[model samples]
Target: MKKFIATLLAFGLVATLGACGAKESETTNPPAATGETGATDTTETTELQTIKVAATPVPHAEILNACVDMMAEKGYKLEVTEYSDYIIPNTAVEDGEEDANFFQHTPYLDQFNTDNGTHLVSVAKIHYEPMGIYPGKSASIEEVPDGGTVAVPNDVTNEARALQLLAAQGLIEIDPEAGLNATPKDITSNPKNLEFTELEAAMLPNTVEEFDLNVINSNFAMAAGLNPATDALASEGADSEGAQTYANVLVVKEGNEDNEAVKALIECLTSDETRAFIEETYGGAVVPVF
Candidate 1:
């Protein structure tokens, strides 16, 4: 079967009043009514609140950028700060330096919380970017010789995701019960005896040429101008176990998931406007779950 490069988008809220094709409700002002002082009763407009979010440069930051103006219209200033690596974004949220973050999936977040004892949690499922095995030195899967080196993400969850993708290609075999956290040690069979090299997920795209094949997360592939749909020798699919387990999420410190700004941000992110943006900007590379 031909594998797919998964795309992802988020889901939340009932409707939006402005932007991204979310139309405002039509209303007519009632004839002016005078109060005891013969003055019209007026409602005070709520002040705009600014919320900080951390994201990766490619689709995460780009996707969030599409919602900035729409968020502002909804009484929130959506400030997105871009980070190249995975660690700081979560740490920043844990330390209360960022209001929330976008760019990672639930499994990564769960592992980070367990590994670091941080209090981050996912509030909404956004999109899923399928991991893909992109060519480094080898041009195609069949061309990868025995003893080939495959660079993979070092982080526990992602590394397992990469290994699983490779296993699906019949390039390797791993212990079946190891599941999402499986690693190279779980490989029960290596038909080609491919060597695995672990690296931080962000570094794979920049250094892909140094290896035989690199398992790259779609977001980084996108940033490096590698479209997994076209460039990958093999890729994960939407219906794959990883996709159902790894939809990118909007993460926040556990206690603050219900903040007003966070709620509005969720509304804008999952709004029709954002769904359209994901579809147009990323094509099939960033599929919207909503």
Candidate 2:
């Protein structure tokens, strides 16, 4: 009977030891239910980098918004801030308040950098808005009376573009030597005796009807509900030098032009998808330069 009792005690001790050993094994190693090489319940997620950019309304912001999903797929969060005035965008980039800007063309950038002493450089040529001659009081260029009032952009380069466009249309003649810098004073002849009244580019659209004719930038025209392709009397051709000279660009502080985020944004803006969006959305108003 003592031997039997010893046997029972021995079995009990063995069973208890087995249970403890099983528990310890479970505590040290866990089964990876996820089925990865090493099973772990702990999960880690990657965060996206944020790229802040400044842009004008119309095509720049519209174009950038379309690329948000593309940027995310490439692991970046694109944030755009809209500005009405041109100065703030470049200054914002120069002051480090923005990663980049997408509004002004390289010519405007060169002028801004020279005037404000800002160090901004273009990373990519995105698109160009052809300057269009939108009729106001005059139903057509031919209907304009002698000394008809014309509204033109006050900015230097744009004013020259306006004059060049008028000259090209045979409304007036300007010195060929003046080139892109032609102004009202550079007119070599005036067939209609048209008088130019200079105003801020953005304001031309608002008071368009008050003048006989208004030379408006494509962006401002579109913002005021005018389609350049259908509404304007005339605009730049796709093969025009304006395509290169006035093409809107992705710009950044000179030193940051080559940064990874800026490069990514450039890639997205110049992508085939972006080109398709521009062609379909703006028609001929905005042309992709890339």
Candidate 3:
């Protein structure tokens, strides 16, 4: 009887050891991935798409900077390259060095493509910086003496725009057929007999003091401490044909019109926030065309 009881006790001890070992094994090595662990492991991460854009310094870069946060929210990152000259932006886009540019108008783009044989297109019309006639030696158009020297941009498109602005104010009459491509030779009427001196668009600001009146592009005018809204002797009105025709545009390489990243950029630029920012910041010097 004593031996039987001892045997029974030994058996009970072995069973307890086995149960503890099993419990430890369960703790150390979890069961193969069950549905519980595997089902909850579905965290997803989205990668942001990056787009590079070239722009002018003042309003274009400022406007693009404002949209950075808004774009990031949409899974896109905007990288802006500021260019002071108008030529490089388009060339950069054409060469694929930049994804898009924001410093030119449709007419200028058309002329550039024609001139350089680059394939570029406008993605969206952003703003209009009205060409303005600013005072140099003369305070007003009527005050200018006959045969007064007026400075204009040498670039084909902008010189044409400058002439058009003068024509709009009755200072001159451009050949109706010449239209946006008009040159000084296209002038059919010049009651003031104003002599046009064509210079680099960027040089017009510094040379303004030398001429009787200067037809300055709004961007250059603003850069030279002149305000198109107030300092300009005369400016293109928001409703003027020039304003509608020369609205500065967002441009891209021809085939990138439907690019997803470019589309996101356009959406941010044309957003209500961007419109309000332009209206408030530039006060009328830069008009939002939507």
Candidate 4:
């Protein structure tokens, strides 16, 4: 009877120890996951977009440079490529090699698109650089000798602007129908009987001294160390229709007008800060139209 009780007690002790071991295993080792795979939830990070623009070296690139930090703050990068000629910038944008361009006005852009068969559009009109009649051999309009030559830009849009400036100064009269697309053929009356020399817009500055007076684009005039606000014998007034019509604009490919990067650029360009910069930098040679 005593042996039987001791054996039973030993069996009970073994079972208790086994149960405790099983409990500890459950607490420490846990059950192996059955037919289940672990998964990690992750989010993708998006990279910022870069905007590339073609621009003239003067006020356009300089103005874009000022907006670089502002764009970066808004999570974008602005890359400005300087272009000396007018043709390549529009072509670059049309070909998608550049995101936008900033060297031309609406009329010039319209003419370019029509002539090149490219679908480019303006996103914003930023500023205007008045077309000025700068004296070369002649100091004033009154001093221009009869039949003296007056140089003008050979391009269609700029030639019209030059004619308009001449008309404004009473040196000549343009047909009312010629409007912004006028040429020498559109001239109705020439009081001075001045001869017109049509040359490339960029060449006007260099040839200014050769002609009695040269109609100079403000950018080229500034590049030649002439101030349109001061040195010009006659310039388009701020309130003039020409000033409103010839304001330089931000341009992009037609379908990309609403692109986020382009939108950001337009915002930066038209901001009050940019306006102030134009006023301070060019000293009214370039007037903010935004």
The top-ranked prediction according to lDDT is 4
Candidate 4: where is the Cα deviation over 4 Å? 1-48
Q: Can you tell me which runs of candidate 3 are displaced by over 4 Å?
A: 1-47
Question: CA lDDT of each candidate?
Answer: 0.89, 0.88, 0.89, 0.90
Give the alpha carbon lDDT tens digit for every residue of 18-52 in model 3: 99999999778656644774443334778888899
Error of 2 at 86 (Å): 1.2
Q: Write the per-residue lDDT of candidate 1 for residues 1-290, one digit (tens) a residue.
A: 12322221112222231343433222334335466566565666687789999999989999899999999898888999999999999999999999999999988988889999999989998888988999989988899999999999999999999999999999998899998989999999998989999999999999988999999999999999999788888888889999889999999998998999999999988999999999898878888997
lDDT of 2 by residue, 1-290 (tens): 99999999999999999999999997888655686776667566779999999988887889999999999988899999998777788889999999999888888889888899999998888889998999899999899899899999998888888988888889999898988888888998998888889999888899988999899888888888999999999887777666558988889888886788878888899899999999999977898877
Error of 1 at 283 (Å): 1.2
Question: What's the ranking of the predictions by TM-score, best on top?
Answer: 2, 1, 3, 4
TM-score of 2: 0.87
Candidate with top TM-score is: 2
Error (Å) of candidate 3 at residue 86 is 1.1
RMSD of candidates 1 onward, in order: 20.9, 4.3, 6.4, 9.3
For candidate 3, the lDDT comes to 0.89
| Residue 6 local lDDT, model 1 | 25
